[model samples]
Target chain A: MEKTQIEELVAKYNEGVADPKEIKWIEQLIESGEIDLTQLRELSGLDEQIQKMEVLSPSLNLDDRFYAALANEEKQIKKGTSFSMPSLSFLLPRLAMAAALILSGFGVGYFLQSPAQKSEVSELSQEVNDLKEMMMLSLLEKESATQRLKAVSLTSEMSQASEKVTNALFVALNQDDNVNVRLAALEALKPYVGKSSVRMKLIESIEAQYSPLVQIALAELMVSIHEKKSVNALRQLLENESMPKEVKTKISESIDVLI
Target chain B: MEALSDNALMMKVKEDDLGKMSLLFDRYKRPLYGFFYGLNKEQELSEDLVQNTFLRILKYRHLFHGEGDFRAWMFHIARNVNNDHHRKKRVKATEDLDNWQERIGHHENQSNEMQHNEEHNMLSMAMDRLPEDKREVLLLSKFEEKKYSEIGEVLGCTEGAVKVKVFRALQELKVIYKQLEKSH
Candidate 1:
């Protein structure tokens, strides 16, 4: 059909006088995009009214339900991404099997031990501690604060820490970028504070510390250990221009107590 | 910070930044609710369907490749949610229409605003008289703002087919509305 003929059909439909065949032709025209639904005056008016109709806004109850669902989903996501312990029912059998294996291994080792094997066992234990210390030191060098914290915590599992381990802890305490890791390093070093070398390093660490948290902790540690040598270092810290007044007061109080 | 585009937010949601889903929810909840409420005319059921639509969005978030329009993808899920609801209930669309006047009365009693507008009340009755498919097409047209192509994406049809659906729906609605006006 020509454009004028299609226009006539649309006009007929809009006038509400179109026969069925003309309405069918109008439908074809609408489908073909030659005529829009908006061209039909009555239908367009109805569509406009439908569009103008106002919907009631959902109540706060919907918000409550949606946010509750969202929060629940977020919890599920977190649980999926983070480590979570298995159910005790699921873990019981596995735990029993692991315990049996460890006990049998220990039994076999104990029965097989002679004086020569005993010395070799000591050597093996030393080598294991060495490996742990190496792993800890390497982890301490990691960029992640969590990894560094894990490294600091690893020292607590060692029955005897070598000088290398102590030196690594000192390095972490003095230079680690994370405050929590530094605090963990300080806690790890506390067990060895009775050593003259460790005490001197602890005193030395006081002046290098800038964080009031670490400075206060160190002052409290010095006061706890009765390390009077820390007074001069603490005094030097008080002299440092950038020291927080509270830390300076804390250090002064420690110095007076030590004197 | 600039607001992320819908696809960008959805992409983040797919990547497990699930918090971004809240942004998408806040944006679409009302429109989705309108679409569902337009279909069911029951406030609580419509709200439930809207919630179900979002839950499906989160569950199948991985399927959203961010290449298509987010709104279209959302309506696709919403259409399915509405269908699943009716399918599960086995409630006939005609039955809902049979109860349309009762539902309208209930709505009018619940909301004085609906009572104030006789034309919209008549239009709502006309919409309820439509078959589920026709009512759905009109609701999609209204909520989707006559973006027939996106409506097509939701309906799994072409743009022309969607336009024809809207045309037919409007034609029926006009007839029903006229009858309603004459009766009143």
Candidate 2:
């Protein structure tokens, strides 16, 4: 069709007198991009009104739900990306560099030491031990039973513990709230039990324990170490009216063995 | 600086900067809601479909290669969510006629309450009367700002095809609007 014919067809449609066949032709024109929706007057008015129609704004509940879901999605994405294994190609060079640095450090420390430097190194070692002792004491004071257990376990790493360290272990064995930490403290004190002061403290601690597990453990340790003086503390424990019968029987047997 | 484009924000979301989704949601929520509300005419359900569209966007963010318009991709998901809801509702509708009647009555009450202006009320009533496919095309034309090519992307057709769809929908709408005006 010529441009004039298409124009006349659109005019007739706009004037609302188009027959069914003419409307079909106009639909074909629209599909062919010959006539725009805007050129058809009545439909354009309706389209404009549809566009201008007011839509109610979504409530704050929608915002809350959307942001909540987005936050959950973000959390999942973070969890997915947080622990991806590094490719071997990316890790190999850094690993080689770190190994080389460690080897060089050992070589330098072994070769460069003299008498004065040895003394300085020994002093540095002493300062580190002091820091560890302070850290252990402070950690034993922590509220978390796991932290106090960690503090007691730190003593196993030391070749020689200071008096303050042993005192902290004694405090933990007698007064710590968690039985596991107290048990750990008892095990940690075992290595130092050869010292008379540590042995005396252990014997004293025998009377302070209320838990049957700790009481049985202390009684077993006393019998293992053959501490004859703990017989009095064991007898005192036997005198406690509230002590379980099994524990009193165990302590009585330990006292008889010591005698 | 100008705000990031929807495609830019979506690409960032694709790259695992998931917070960027909030920006896209803010930009499109109202228009998306309007599109759903135009078709469903229930405010809460429309809002829910809008949220489902964004949720799907986040879920499939990795698949968005940033080659196409973000709004078009969103409407594609919105159409699926709407269709899924209606599909499930259709099954339930067969099981319960009383519930369907109650819903119809509720929709009428909701439309009456929401349509404060008389002309807009008549137009909204006419829109509700339209068949789903025709109503969808008109709502897309309105909310998408008549970007026929992008609407075509959403509907899986050509720009010319989208224009024809808009024309047909509007022609029917005109007849319905005239009937509504006379009855009112």
Candidate 3:
């Protein structure tokens, strides 16, 4: 066979569509020294080499990011830009779980608080709540920012917040480096603002916050909650020479409303 | 029982069972990552492209006709997403393949591992120089193991065209790889 014929045969052989006759011809050529088998072998090995290349894994949060994105899209689908209370259908299952946990806690509390045991039922109940709070705090301390956000969001699912949960939120608000996590902590703390301690913390956080967005958000929250005590904090914030004009204005107006 | 196919899972996604997307994601993320990683060799950007691909999949889930191969449709979307990213960062995306070693050199330990795989490294650099279309065709066919029919669907060409492309791409790749090998 000529060189052109050998090249044609090699191409066919590499394409994996060579006939038995063509295969025989290639074998005959290799025997007769018309074509180098090594070259043809290398040509055929390209695909196999590519396949042998290692597959790369994306970061660990790929799934978490996907689910978070999916949930976000689903929420947008179910409720446009409008404000709608979380539907009872959605809340029922979570509510039932919380209720079941509380009932079981009560049962254990009752069993442990008999006459011989001499432990107060309230103390046992408080201990259960404390355990739940400890779990929340531990979750918040996770390395993943998503886990910390999840921990903050879980506070809203609790039947009620303990002092520890509220304190954890305050700590997250003032210290979390990620703006989104801190913002999530703020949103989670919204329902608890009626508490005097929460109100005091929100007022005090005004001075501690470095993020203009969080400071503005805290000021607005304090004003909305009608915490008269925040007037001093707002006034003190107004005294900071480097305060942005926009936030300073917001604080002054909030102070006017409070006074 | 056999698990649900990609098309079936995607059909479920189209019908508002969005949770089924997780199943689809689990099945396809690695392949998608492989495709993007092959294109740019940047892990973070590749991961971002994968995310953008899935997000587009959801955003345009309504457009799925439930007719063709779902994986093909996905790669089609992925190609579009990558093209969009390229257009947005065309100037910055022109980094040469030689920089790959320097980029990965930051880890220090992987330097030894990379030296041990010189052929793989050279092959990758050679692959990086192929025209994007040929490169993608080769990747989808050789790496992802898609059939000519699926590659055609993804590339919007005929199976015959894809077959011709695969042959031509392999020939071109061999020529390029030899040059790179000699230079190395």
Candidate 4:
């Protein structure tokens, strides 16, 4: 196509008139350089010139600044500073642990003094008070992780930095043995779950979380995306009558809400 | 992390290396300024946005995690800074029109040949005519040196879809240029 001919095709495409065949021809010509649409290239260059005139022509290059920024960022890393990870929350109650030791020290003195919370303790333990505490801890941890994840999408500048955090989280999510830990990691990852690369990995882990609780969580997340294609994927599980009832129920509910 | 990456610089900034942070600021200040100047044609505001982008970069340095493509990330930040400034100031529609006359006047005395470069002026005038999203895609792809696929990733579209948008954008340019030619 000549310059004007290519321009005409573009014009038609712009007007929504060019058929697929004409579009293909235009693409092929531009790609192969069969027709010298030098005029069009020059036109493209005009935008480039104005851009250069505005943005690039003014500054020194970016290399030195990047190096300086890196130097500052890495100082602590180079200093061999090691951050101690916080102690895990699943430890036994400290007061009970203390009381057992203190039982030997003197008369059997109870830990003291809140009679009201104490009265309800017997009933609560039978309801598995420890498990409730653990669940509460998990919920707190989930909230904390969620807050951390939110900073990722909060600004465009942090994109590269966020990706790094995502990479680290992915490794933790995949390899961590504790289902609760993995669940926490998944919650931290929920905001970034839409990226195809991340979504695929999340999908792969759904089956491995054989616990019904985890499956329900994953199923709800699975169909939450606005994309219909994701809903269809969950619908596949819904169609499988032999699939676990809990997973199907979760997916079916999500599909209903999403669709 | 690669030595030259923004993540590496962010690490340095975290270490309290003011000198490195300064260099990074200096490095980005111009391109960032140019980015704003391309749109607003106001050097002072461009400089202010450039400085503010660096300040925000520094403020958020501790938040750094290594990621792909730092330059694009920085540009995204700069883009937001410009928008934020626009929001705070609220340039009225007529003010932008006034700007066109003043901005065009900056080069009015140039040779006839330079004036005849309809392609150059047409782009700005055409982009000014476009909806905001269309103009954004063109600027990012053409001026920022971002690949079409990368632009799609940034804009949340497929590369093929971005290609379609670019085609329309250029057609808009041609039509506006033709109209200008007719008016003369």
Candidate 5:
């Protein structure tokens, strides 16, 4: 393709006038891998540095964690809770899924309107709830499996003894309302959190935060202590009347694992 | 295992398989994390976005019924969650000092020589020259390895639109590169 053709397509693209065929042409260039990518970065002036910086900049480990949250999110949906996606495409997929799901849902709803089907549906919902609880437990376990710091500091020393960094992370974790930030802080705190004495407050943060994820992380940390005292602590949290049932169940499950 | 695809792991999670969540987490945590890291210089913000992304997943787990490839679904989630975050913050991500330090330090480690360092430096400099929308399309498609469809999903444009944006982004980059070459 002539360079002008590519540029014209791009102009149309910026103007929202590009045709689909022209789009495909540009994609072919990108897929062919002939173009240098650094030039395409969103933030100008950083590509040269990011490339240079790429070596020291270790890859982020948020993908798995996002998957786990998504798993919990599914459960929340089953329990009649819903969150919207910000992507414009969300409306499209959601509308499509809603159509598909609601149609199937209506068919099933009508067929199941019979007494027996209703009973069966209720039974399925119960099983689903159990599954949700079970998933919650597993998610909690996964969150606890690591000291949050294991995410960044590959070496034990780096993960620990870096008071400056740890404190910075803690401040970020507790103050950052964005769950990802808190989770990252919790992960970053992993190295420092294992201290039997100083880390007891994590359980408090878990409670105060009111986020299931932090609760899971704290519950996981406590479960690994293997000390009878820690189990008692988890049992106390599990049995606390003020604690939400979901959290209580999570605490119980983690305790069960320890016991 | 490779045998347990993303759908399978999601199925397992649905079936009360807690370990499967870890299996899923093990697979994409870094890639997703890298996604945020690419957009923001604040390591702390990247972590926060990752957490919210996961929370969104938990809240939307029912949408993850065993049919679709979970990886794409997960990215769909990440993209949405991060966009929401970017909106709420209302802060345009300018270069951070820490990012600069890390970049220069990394170059020093890779090639203590002047030439390769210049190539890396010029490339970044040229990228910094593009407009945000073009740069964003380029970043999502090139660095994030998002499909045209996925890019559209994230940016709310069509796949065709993403292709055009990418093409223009590259052309723009070429212009910047030429400008950099001439300046020297």
Candidate 6:
């Protein structure tokens, strides 16, 4: 048979579409050993070869490696750093460059202490803080809750706090959708509590928080700081009969102490 | 209850429900590993390719359109990962028959088994000798049991092209197998 005829026959045979006469012809061709059955036999033999393939088991920790990569990716996505930071290893070089820039700036400032240059040095130093604040603010505005939480953590590395940082943390605490992130934002704001705005916002957010855990955390923070202004919020929490009994008791104790 | 389909799971992945990736991985990792192994006959490289395939899926999940079979999209990524790996390493698909047998754990202790082992090794090495494109078509069609249409999707070709390629590849594979057998 011609090559096309054989291919047509083989395709039909494999698909089980060959008629009885065609099947008999294929059988006779194979039995006569005139038509090579290498392709057909090889196709059938693959099932056995596949069965015999050494059953390769990858490293036992393959899943662990995959999951670790996944988790690391999740961390990056949450931090809004997925595009910027491909891996933890990439951070080191960028950080070194930042450090070198800072050191060079200080070195330049130290040598150029003339009065006009001194003013320039102070402005440059202020620019660095402004840049840091700008980064924190942008990170805080990211949509990923994990990224927002990372922003909260990144604040701890800041050389100095600013009102903008305080405001961003307050927004995260009062309005973030994710409970853990909101709690993280509250934690970030704890050190800035000396700010009367932070104190007032923390007090005001008590009524806005629906999570009993946040309410309890707020009540504890208010009681610990002895913020006498939280008295009415605690009183309001007490009136809400749906409050978890534990939270109600905590709020009651907070109200008594505040009074 | 019917489990969520692969396309649904992939759609969830695209939507950033990344944890759903674990389910897809559980379903596909073995077959993917086998496909790579069939091409390269190397365990470490095949596993690395599998890992890379999954990583690429995660990195590019947004590109998935959720229209056709999820397996087709995934294998498309897998083929790309394998091609990239092959390019970087300059790994020719061909391996010597003895090396293939040894890697596959052929032994001379049993004469009967040795005969069978030699035939299996010849077939594998013959497969390895096929040009990469033909070998890929053959592996997808014969070993992976993917339909020509699905293979076309994975290979970025039309179904008719895949059918022609499968037929021509099988013919070439048969020639190679005959030569290997004759030499043996």
Candidate 2 residue runs with Cα over 4 Å from true position: A83-259, B95-120
Native contacts present in candidate 6, fraction: 0.08
- Rate residue A222 of model 5 by lDDT: 68
Cα deviation at A250, candidate 5, in Å, is 46
Encode model 5's per-residue lDDT on A1-259: one tens digit a residue.
6777656655565565557786566467655543333334442233333333342123345545555555665565456645655888758887898799889998987875879878888888666655543443233323443433333233223412344444555554566555665776676566665665447655545545556677677778767655445665566555557777777788788878878
Query: Which interface RMSD does candidate 1 score?
Result: 1.0
| CAPRI-style docking class of model 1 based on DockQ | medium
Give the distance in Å from residue A1's predicted Cα in candidate 2 to where it truly belongs.
Answer: 0.8
Per-model DockQ against the true two-chain complex: 0.49, 0.51, 0.21, 0.15, 0.09, 0.08
Model 3: what TM-score? Answer: 0.48
How far is B121's C-alpha from truth in model 1 (Å)? 1.6
List candidate 5 stretches off by more than 4 Å. A1-259, B66-68, B91-120, B143-146
Candidate 6 CAPRI grade: incorrect
- Candidate 4 residue-wise lDDT, B77-142, digit = tens: 777888898786555544566667654565453333233433456545555666666667667775
Candidate 1: clashing pairs of residues:
none
Of models 5 and 6, which has the larger lDDT?
6
Residue B122 accuracy (lDDT) in model 3? 81
Please provide, for model 4 over A1-259, each residue's C-alpha lDDT reduced to its tens digit, 9 standing for 90 to 100: 4777777876675566778788678656655544333335534554555455433333333344544545655664556666765555634566567887887554433555368866677656545644433343344334455543333222222322245456655554555555565566677678776688878877766545545565567767776655444565556556666678766776778778777
**Model 1 regions more than 4 Å off:** A84-259, B91-120
Better of 1 and 3 by TM-score: 1
lDDT of each: 0.88, 0.88, 0.80, 0.59, 0.60, 0.77
Off by over 4 Å in 3: A1-41, A80-259, B91-120
How many clashes in candidate 3? 0
Question: What digit string (tens of lDDT, one per residue) describes model 3 on residues A157-201?
Answer: 676897888899999998988878888899999998777778778
Give the least accurate 10-residue stretch of model 1 chain B, judged by summed lDDT.
Answer: B110-119
Give one digit per residue, the lDDT tens place, for model 5 in B24-61.
66666666666665555345566777677666665566
